[model samples]
Target: MAEEEISQISAGEFEAVSQLLSSSESLQLAFIIMILGIIGIVFGYRKFSSWVGSQKFYYKRPHFSRFVRRAVLPFFAIALITAINVHTQTGVLFGEISSIEDETISAHEQFAKILNTFNILVIGYTISHLVPIILTKREKSILEKEDFDAWFELRGFSDDSEDLFHKLYKWVPPNNAPEDIDEKEFQELLNTEKGRQYLEQFRTSKGNPIGGYEKLVDNPFEEWKKSERAKYEKYYQNCITGNNQSGRKLKPGTKPDEIFPIDVWREEKREHGYESLIPSSRPPGYAKKKREGLPKSAKQILPLGIFLATILAVVAWWGVDLIVLATATGGFSIGLGLALQETMQNYFAYIMIRKDKIFVEGDRVQLETGYNGYVHKITPRVTYIRDALNESIAVIPTRQLVNAQIVNYTKENKLVPAVVKVGVSYLNNPRQVASILVKVGKRGMREIVDTRGRHLVKQKRCPYLDKNKPSCGCDKELHVDATQPVVRFNEFNDSSLDFSMWLYVRDYGAQFKTKTDLRMIMYEEFKKYDIRIPWPIRTVYQGDEKKEFEEISELDPDRDKVIDEFGMGDIGRGEGDE
Candidate 1:
């Protein structure tokens, strides 16, 4: 089209056209044509503007208004200006005002024709390329409408809310709304101020419906089973399987489905995929398995590659002498040997860790050296322990961990066994002491009181609840119910009966507080019962006669004076020591 325009516009034709346009009548005609084009652009913009939105159907299509404003209208406007310029300047749009050698009116006219050809090409290209694209996009909007209607039908949308649906389609909810909305949920959501704000956002921003939202029409269990059956069938057909060690093969008379059911076949197929030499081997449409993190080798590979590259680059760039190269090679060999040694040691530690099922990350552990902390991370090189007492991280080499004994507080369970040892004077009855210890251990004084208060409140709120019901008929058992404290006599000390009371606590970190509380409670109980914790009694033998001190008390005010008069310190002094 552009070439034809250029070829037809000869020197005579260009002069005639320019002369005709130069006239006021011809200028007015050109202005009318431009005005008509502008009107056409406005109408086109308005016709397509309604469908443009953040919604998928509208979003897929280019905005008609933008194309008109940016491309169509601008092109016509420029063409109008070009025509006017040719009329006034003897057909040359960019003609120089200064008189130049070999510059002719015909040359200027030819230049105008060439410029017009470029404009024609651009306009023609837009028509040929852009029109079909825009036209094809019209189907998306139609399809969206059809889907919307179909969804309402499937979901049994009330006909009474037809007006509301129409309004929603015409104007989207506010931008802050969920892209996919159920009308009932939308209504309920709009009851709140936040939801109202969201709706307003959806409306303002022209939020789109979620893609395929309407298509998710069924989710029945039987239908799901059917779908799963079909999926398994596809998997069995495509995926390979191996015979069982039992040599169980379908007999000639037996049906394959009966001998090896679809469910069993599916499981076998899955196991095959997992045990395959190729990790990526999977049945068609199967979801890709997700890895929690990068493999150890993968993590190490990048750094190792960089290190090797750096060594090579340094050697090449420096152009080191033969002696230097030999020296470097020796150093490299030594370093490699050391690295291999460390790597082997770490690998052994890793094997030990796995084989023993030792404390994993997150377990509270106390190392043999009395370093108590949570296992933060376990890697081949080192195990990171986060020490709560010191509020710092302790990095212990894996080799050291493998050699040392570790007390895993919460390895098997979060609950940790805790003991509080107490000694009371022999004057107190052993049976009574043990009973008191058991009582205190079973129900921690303050903790028991709080638990009772909570239970009372719960029972009061729901009066129909059975008082005898364990854990109030809930699946969860209370921590108090789970850990019944036990008391046992440890040993008889010189002046007191030693006993240890044991109980379990949920958090391993709570051991200290629990011990403190239990001890305090036992002390109060002992004081109430007048059960004394006896001080040590001393007997002195002088001149082959033994003198026994009865009911000796450390709190006795005159004890220090008595000790001084006896000269016990001098008597206990080492021989020949001044």
Candidate 2:
């Protein structure tokens, strides 16, 4: 397209198209073909597209559809642009009277046309690529064939080559005991309708349906011999024939049991031997039916193709109109202004957060506003998080999440060894108490402790720090400037020495469970040692100390020195009431 545009046609590429046009005599006809070439691009593309739509490529891989959309747009664009380029760059033929310079105008016009064609090709490929995907179809490949195979192997059926009918012998257990079969598995086979349908199709196609001895019997040469003797006769004949080996030449001393008879694998019993090659030959669909497993089908890629085509159509007409309208008049771009405000904010913040890579789903995150929760689902617009209690969920906008201070409990790593604190008697050994608390924490949530994470978590590297060593969850990270409670001795109580000890936690949600375990372990461990938690104490005083009479009480008793305590001061004598 570029070569054709700006009259920048390469000599070889021009010659290739020019040679074909020269063979035709009519210049007018040649010009029309160029027009049709532009038109044929549309037609050929539709034909190619119709062919593409017929194919079922993405039937199984419905999830990975965005890649198809991204690929398809570019392909259509390139094909259209190339066709237009081939048409325009090879200038339409003029009569012999025309000079090369006379043809320059048509060349320039075609060049402009090619340039404009390509410009339309690539308008907004990126926005549609990054947009949230909502495909037309939504079917999961639930009944994968392998799940069925595992289910079937649980049953007595072997692989395809082992049908077992040839070596079939029903075990005539000494007392005719009942056979054991799983009802759940039998029910599952019947329940899987799609699998059953596929199996029926496969069986019909192969002209077999897992036939048993009775189903295959049809009739005997002697239907007249319908007695019990016939049953025993057929059974014994097959059994003894396998053991006898009448066809093979044998040495005189070699007995049937000693000669490794095929009938009885264990030489102790020379009975009818059976091998399992028939079941292995069973069609793959048979196993699937037996196990209630079904083969996966591909997703409909054409729906995505049609959807992208509509997006392109809208983008071309509406997008070009908007741009052209604004460009023609000096109108303000209200849409651009509104779009940029939100888009730019999200774009920059998404970059920063992605670059930082601090938190992920399932982490307990606390906002600066005191909204604390477990990260449930993170969408582009909002993040849904369950509160620390796990009862209520909070929807945090991207703007708030990006602007606010966020802390993750399982940020660095999981298996966060947490501690429990109690204000017990000062006599208690804080070290033993810490040990017991840690033990309780380990045993309490050992089952629920999740270890699935990046390699860094397992390796215990930087960023995924070990909080217990020097860092603790109770305190805000030292690097962060946030309100954190440093150690404080708030009071001195009566029965026990009061102090606050902040401890670590794996997550805030686990706070309740860890607290319970800690209280239990502390109670159990503190019983061995006499550690008591004290309550607040208050003291009582009898007399009012607001006014003092201490100096008058020390004075030697004299009629002149005696003083009153009721309305008393350290004064001499009062004669009048005033």
Among these predictions, the greatest lDDT belongs to 1
Model 2 misplaced regions, further than 4 Å: 1-104, 107-331, 334-363, 375-385, 395-419, 423-492, 496-511, 526-578
Question: For residues 84-182, could you state the per-residue lDDT of candidate 2 as single tens digits?
Answer: 555545553332213223353353343434345444444334333433233322211222233223222222222222433222222111121113324
Tens digits of per-residue lDDT for model 1 on 299-332? 2344455445544443343343434444546656
Off by over 4 Å in 1: 1-341, 344-357, 413-415, 445-483, 536-578
Query: Against the hidden reference, what TM-scores do the models get?
Result: 0.33, 0.35
Question: What alpha-carbon RMSD in Å does predicted model 1 have with respect to the real structure?
Answer: 29.4
List all candidate RMSDs to the true structure: 29.4, 28.8
Give the range where candidate 1 is weakest over 10 consecutive residues by summed lDDT: 455-464
Per-model CA lDDT versus the true structure: 0.48, 0.39
